[model samples]
Target: MRGEFAHLGDLPEKQVCHECIGEKYLSGQIEVEGIPATCDYCAEIETPCLSIVEIAGRVQTAIEQHYSMTPDGPDDYQSAWLRDKESDYNWEREGEPVQGVVAELLCAADCIAADILELLSDRFDCRRPGDPDEGETEFAHTSFYELKAHSHRDWDRKWQRLEVALKNEVRFFNQEVLDVLKSVFNNLHQMQFRTLDVAVVQVGPSTALEALYRAREFQSSLDLKKALESPVGELGPPPGKYARAGRMNASGISVFYGSEQAHSALSEIRPVVGSNVVVAKFSIIRPLHLLDLRALKTISFKGSLFDPSYAEEKQRIGFLSTLTDRLTVPVMPGEQEREYLTTQAVADYLAGMSEPELDGILFPSVQDGKGVNVVLFHKAALVEPLAKTGRKVVSASIEDIDYEFDVRHPEYEINTETIEELGGSVPMLPLFFDFDAHLESLRQPEHREPSLRLELESIEVHDIKAVVLQTTVLPVRVTPQRQHRAGHTESGEPKF
Candidate 1:
């Protein structure tokens, strides 16, 4: 083994001890294979260590596995690769001194660092050091080893393919598109399981206690009062037949859309001035498994650089960081039917998944940048009936109930005085008017369990006086040019 590293000729036989190494994993490796010897860099007596030659060889192998040599200069036809005003391309490199690399992996001493660099010179390339005139060493300053992390090219191509397939090639029953989505989301699901806290959020009355606000614009006060009377039925997710296509759901597919902020919900409905907007707060009843897309923006994966799938995992993470924006990008009016297909498919697929089943998605609100929005799947979108009773209804039943609205405070006051008498003497009790049980009795076999409970007191009616618009203004410059005649130059020469 000594003869194999002849390039390390005349270097001290003293071992580079594990105590001198900075990288934990590399130091651990050295500790396992080391024998008791004097350390060359730290001058430690009888320390666990490996020789300079051995350490350099290990580093060379690891670098070969994780890095690639960058091109020295731009090709003849590829001028774009060259940096502006430079003869050689300003390629990305480990922009650190030879000593720096050694310090990062080993000790930051000149003698041992120079020895390691000399031994690996044939296997590595580096940037020329600063001029001696500028008080700098003649040795190389930076290593030309590029880390082999995956790039956006692969993920971008796959996304484009899927987008095209969904919008143009095959909108429905496309196995290829489905398979691609499955691969992406399955990886995401696995990542969520690995990082439970950041990816999956628990929303319920006892857990995070998330209060979601939903708003509807009404043409008249009459319609607003009707919605106020039955907030669960009117303000919750609409029936399937009345459902319209949205960012996360296709037409006829009912889903819950709510915002963390009341203003955000009101803005989403786009109510005009002088229009009536009814806003209601809904509480999460049972525990919900919501995938937090906002968290995905900052989510990361930790793995060994030497792992074979490390680069791929990095790519997947990079893609996920940008996925929230892709899913929530606002589509222009009339173009939503086509633009929403990809996100709609994603929501549908996530809803159908059984393993690590997701009830909904929590994403950044597009209408209100500072707020967040939630879209619960049809299965988890059912709003619990406002009225309920623990006791079973026997024979007593409510004939009628008077509903009064407080215009000043914007609250609904249900009057039970109009309740009819069951047997002239025995008045119909309020306990017999169990809305939940009645709804359950009338529920179809396929009806899903309710997940949200509307807080009747949280209802609000807003008269839109003004709307503040947040926008970015781009200047349009009109440059005047001398108009050239058809097939003629600016100087009016013969057309060529």
Candidate 2:
């Protein structure tokens, strides 16, 4: 072993102990069965030690396994001819000095012997300060050393396959695709849990987002009062039969689409000029587990370079970072059905997850960048009844038998003096109707207890006179070409 590396330099006979080595892995090996002797590196009296020559070989093995030499050639070579014309062939060879690499492997500590590093540098054919052809070079040996690129080609291919599959191939009922999604999302969920402070967010009655806005557009000729009096059935998500295909739901599937901001709700409706838009706020009454796609844009992954799973984890992090754009890119008017298939499939997958049981997805609005859009699955889309009172009225009736009806306003002093004069006890008026039963009769058996409540007082009616559009204008250059009629000549020759 010593003869093999004799050409490098004089082999250091000094015995260096494991304590002199800064790297944990290498030091552990030396500590196991190394002979007890004086350590020349650290100048210790007696310790578990190995010859510097043996340590040098171990360092070389680690470097070869984990790192590679960066190419020193000019990156922007114009052509093969230009590369061939160059006299310097330095680019053909790669790698930094083995001395610097050894230092890095041992963590650049003073306890590491300089002699062992010098010996390794001579044995390894590395780019150094002095060479036969070149006297000296500006490049430092450390600059040329780089950790080898992780082998993640399989993941890249899989991601590409998924993109193609979602776009043109099988989108539904593909076990292969589902398996991939299961793996990816499982890992993502685990990562989110590890960083609970910044990942998935919870929204409910207690959160800052207690309510969300939903808007509906109608013809200006519609009665504003009647629209205002519309029940939750009309104001909330439409029934399955009336549900239209949207970004997150297919036709015939009902899902509640709402926004954190009123403007976002109005923007999503895209009401035409001279139309009426009624916006209502719905209070969230139940705990909603939501995956915030916006947070993916800023989330990061940190792992050790030595870890075998680091590459895969890093790749997953990268995919998640771009996931928002992949799902939210604007689709053209006629291409919506085709373009929405991918997002719809994703939505369905997310809704089906039971491990964490997500209620909905919160994403940035394509219609309004500053606005956030929420899409609750069918399970979470039910709206709570407007009436919360416990009173039960049996029947309702008018006093007079006259056909005419009269409406009037009553005034009263509501202070303590007036209340005291009236004995503070007012008799209950006769019940005119069974309000509770009437509401119960109107409820649909197919729907369950509402997770959301309609805020009647928050409803607003807007008459849209004009629509403001923000657009990016690109200059178009038009070129004119003369047209020629195709006809045979007088002699039956081809015409020009």
Candidate 3:
């Protein structure tokens, strides 16, 4: 009844997905063991739910087309309904579901997103197309739609950018340009369309939302059409009272996601409207079996680990110093210190760092220390640890190298103390050696027996939003040596 599926008739007033139930289990909110990989019960229910989503998409499309074709439909009362399920888009391919579990859920959630948009339109006095130069007559709401695959990482990055732009009150259009455009639009269109009505609607993990928020000069629909029709590259900024008010009219964003992590991240960003954008699932609207099945599949995949506190005084100073040097911010003449360090500026700069830069800040390189210098030789590279101290990470290294003691050989002697001018002990270690062999030895239970150790570390995407890890050098018998090609050694042999 709600979305065109008869099975959706038994919709519960409130329902939670299997993954959420699983999350409860993982978080100790519900204590249960032996959780299965795929919940057969939930899958069966969700399959039918996908049909409702497809139907909703068709219905929404139909409505939009009707409006576009007949701009003036004041007397027209049009509604859409799915005739049959068999003719609807197939939710299965090769006997398997065409979409992922989350995707299927999102597919249904799209209908809910549309409904929310509709509600918003009525509240905002959404102005449909009237005058030629005014605004969109077909669609009353000023919103951009972004559809994408489900990627929590991408969503997090977008939220970070949006937060930065919003907090700084970044201005997109020149006031004069906006005024002229607004006047032109007002005279052309019979209706008034304000920028404040516009909003960024994100369906999945979208890159377009970032562009919309970050663009300094945005052209209206008419401006865009004119630019395409003409040869001029400069169309200028969008015109509206909201356009000149510093921040773009899009004071809010509506994000849709199937995962709990995505919802949690979106909830953190406060918007002028619809910040907590959880989608209504058609699966829940299905029969009573659907509710039971929903209870079966929801599993929590959230993992945890110790993260470094970035707000510590030491870190703050280091971050500011590094940011200044890296970005090349200008200092007042004759003044070695920075004159201004606004919170917004710092946040914006921090947000601009690429993944690698952000990673460096969170888990910086480590210096030589007392504990086992655990040089994680992952895959085929010597993975560097954090430079600063006081953090620990328990991730399973790709490979572990061992330095076995051979008492019969002088190089195995632990008592040998060869001091260097740098005030460090130069132990009797191999000058030139095979990294693979060394790593294998470390893995070996005995000096001669080498093997690979598979250790799964608990690392989750949500848990590591920004983590500063502690480190101690893992003790391996092999001395650090430069990587070499096959059959190459400069030293004859190592001595104790």
Candidate 4:
């Protein structure tokens, strides 16, 4: 009610305050209610906006294109979220349909994205524009809603009993999403659904950033490119898109009320949440990409980093190269495959390297003058949380929760590496690329390698003594005290 207001004609057309507009929007200065604050562009588009109902209809169509239920169908790899038929499920919203649309589109895939804002409900409320009847204007508080799924595993046993595994270990992926949701949850104490558990699989921003690079490389590969260009029967989705399930870039999550109910409901569904066609794609494709060292060596950024417009991809590729060059990573041994270091292999190796090992490489600090040494890549993981039987099963459906941050402070960039080099490992954990074992390794005394360990048992001799020989070399663990710089942890405590 007390904020600035002007008619469309009064505002200058050529003079633009785009930055000012963004600041106002982020700071909650713009709202539906109070005095009518008219801008030239907003007023022009206001009358032409489509109604919310029409927008929902478009969303329905897009959803149909993206998610298919038939086991053998094109979207079979797509995670089952909204039920098979449109009538089976209902769209739930409150406060404002515009807010709902905004929330939904935050993670929605390509098709319905362009027309999102036009669908805002006419009834959508913004605080009254001008001075209110009350003493002051009421600003709308931005709220964040997070969906999390956890799985329980029996670490002592190698997943023998589903019951035991469900009881002991909670598994979840989509590390990038959780990190953001948790950070927001921490900062915005007023957020709804505060009672939900906050169990984050500990991964430093750096490791997560490296993993994202690999995800991007996976997405950019020639094989994936060819798959998108040519119609492939095995993969789903419209042309020029890979199957969503194996999508290194996105994921889906389904929150269930209970185990019996979840199973009963999901049984009608084809595969378990994690074992779907999408997961299978990653299983089949990731290793092959890893072994295909040529793919790794051939990775190149599509644009130039020095130019601000094209800086994103270039910055990422440059950082990846800098990190790869810094680390003394060993060749990743391939099974019936060559053991060598390609650019991508180096990325994979560095991704699995523990914080201490990374520190060793980056210690004595070399500065490339890159904006940030670490960057982030996020996948949409599907999360399914069941309530009925309440088995501690952890299910993740990766969804595209587009949240990101940079460790811009020089101190964080300097300290972690410097500390590790001085015979100390930072607390940062190694991000295990193996999805199943990712969270588990975080809870370990030392992070595991990209490959599993193999042991040789001794051969028995009938009458003579026999000896056991060590055939293969195992990975070493990096250990030291955990250090934090400003902007790194939830506490926002800088321990430089």
Q: What C-alpha RMSD separates each model from the true structure?
A: 8.7, 9.8, 31.9, 31.1
> Largest lDDT belongs to which candidate?
1
Question: Positional deviation of 13 in candidate 1, in angstroms?
Answer: 13
lDDT of 2 by residue, 121-144 (tens): 556545546656532222233335
Q: What is the TM-score ranking, best to worst?
A: 1, 2, 4, 3
In candidate 2, stretches whose alpha carbon ends up further than 4 angstroms from where it belongs are 1-123, 126-143, 146-160, 192-197, 220-227, 389-449, 478-496
lDDT (Cα) of model 4? 0.24
Regions more than 4 Å wrong, model 4: 1-19, 22-88, 93-337, 343-496
Q: What's the count of clashing pairs in each model shown?
A: 0, 4, 28, 49
Candidate that beats the other on TM-score, 1 or 4, i.e. the better one: 1
CA error at residue 64 for candidate 2, angstroms: 7.3
| Overall lDDT per candidate, in order of appearance | 0.72, 0.70, 0.25, 0.24
Error of 2 at 105 (Å): 7.6
Ranking by lDDT: 1, 2, 3, 4
RMSD of 1: 8.7
lDDT of 4 by residue, 1-496 (tens): 1112122222212111122122232113223221233333334322222222333444344323332222222243233434555445433322333233343533332222223332322113344668354321111122222221111222112212322322344323434333322321231111212234111211222332122100111122243333222212112121122222210112221101101111221222223222321111111111101111112222344321112333333333333223233232332324112212122223333333332122101111112122112211111111111121122212212223334663322110001111222344344766655664554334333432221010101111111123233356999998654447544554555545
- Candidate 1's C-alpha runs over 4 A off are 1-58, 61-94, 99-119, 122-150, 186-197, 389-447, 484-496
Cα lDDT tens digits, model 3, 1-496, are 3433333243211222333332222223112222333322244232212222332343344334221222321222221223344454322112111122222323334334344344323333444568345533333444322222222343234334543453455534334333322322121111111322111112112322111010111123333223222211111122221222111012111111111222322222222231112111111111110001111112121111111221232222222223322222333434322222222233223222332121001111111111110000111111111111122222221212344753331111011122343534444867888676565446423421111111112111121223233567888797755435444444634333
Cα lDDT for residue 216, candidate 3: 16
